[model samples]
Target: EYGRDNGIRLSAVWLTHDPEYPENLPAAPLVRYGWTPRGELAVVYDRSGKQVRSFTYDDKYRGRMVAHRHTGRPEIRYRYDSDGRVTEQLNPAGLSYTYQYEKDRITIT
Candidate 1:
């Protein structure tokens, strides 16, 4: 399989077969990737075409991931300060954590 972004190989899995039955072996995609218009990875799917994860980017900040969701896992979210530094994080357990940044140090709580 190839990615739509740059024609790059995304995922490829081929079954092995006997030498005489090479034609019986077929290549299959183990994973698939979906890209945003700016070429950012937006979503992922398993070989069965089940959604694995999806990413959400911040509209005001390019390339900034504001949240992501994974199958069977809790969704994680992030909040960025004006400087584009992560200021707050919400974990899968619904706990909120805050971060502070200084010129040369970082403080998390």
Candidate 2:
């Protein structure tokens, strides 16, 4: 709600512990939506409010799944360059990629 309403991405969703393990981690109903903290659109707090993930968008603004948050995964590790470009993308397969951006373009291998 706060992310879209003011363009301020909600960093944390603090809540008390519930009787559910991985199923009840969140204390409230999960609502998915788009978020932009600094003009970076993130599919944060997706439906069920239990999952979150980020991706890169092409010029056409298509959602490309770059990273994500899932149940049983309590930690997230990702990085972006000073120019608001993704420097690293980590996936479960250990298949990750680094981006090298130079003057309005991205170089990926």
Query: Which numbered prediction scores highest in TM-score against the true structure?
Result: 1
**Candidate 2, residues 1-109: lDDT per residue as tens digits?**
2223554555444444555665666655356556543455565565466445544444333343334555455333455665556788776656667888778787886
> Clashes in model 2: which pairs?
30-48, 30-49, 32-46
Show model 1 residue runs off by greater than 4 Å.
Answer: 1-4, 7-26
How high is each candidate's TM-score?
0.70, 0.35
Measured over all alpha carbons after superposition, the RMSD of each candidate to the real structure, in angstroms, is 4.4, 11.1
Best of the candidates, lDDT: 1
In model 1, the clashing pairs are: none
Task: Give the per-residue lDDT digits (tens) of candidate 1, residues 1-109.
Answer: 2434356534333345558887765454667778777666788887788889999998877799999989888889999988899999898687879999999999999
Residue 52 displacement in candidate 2 (angstroms) = 7.0
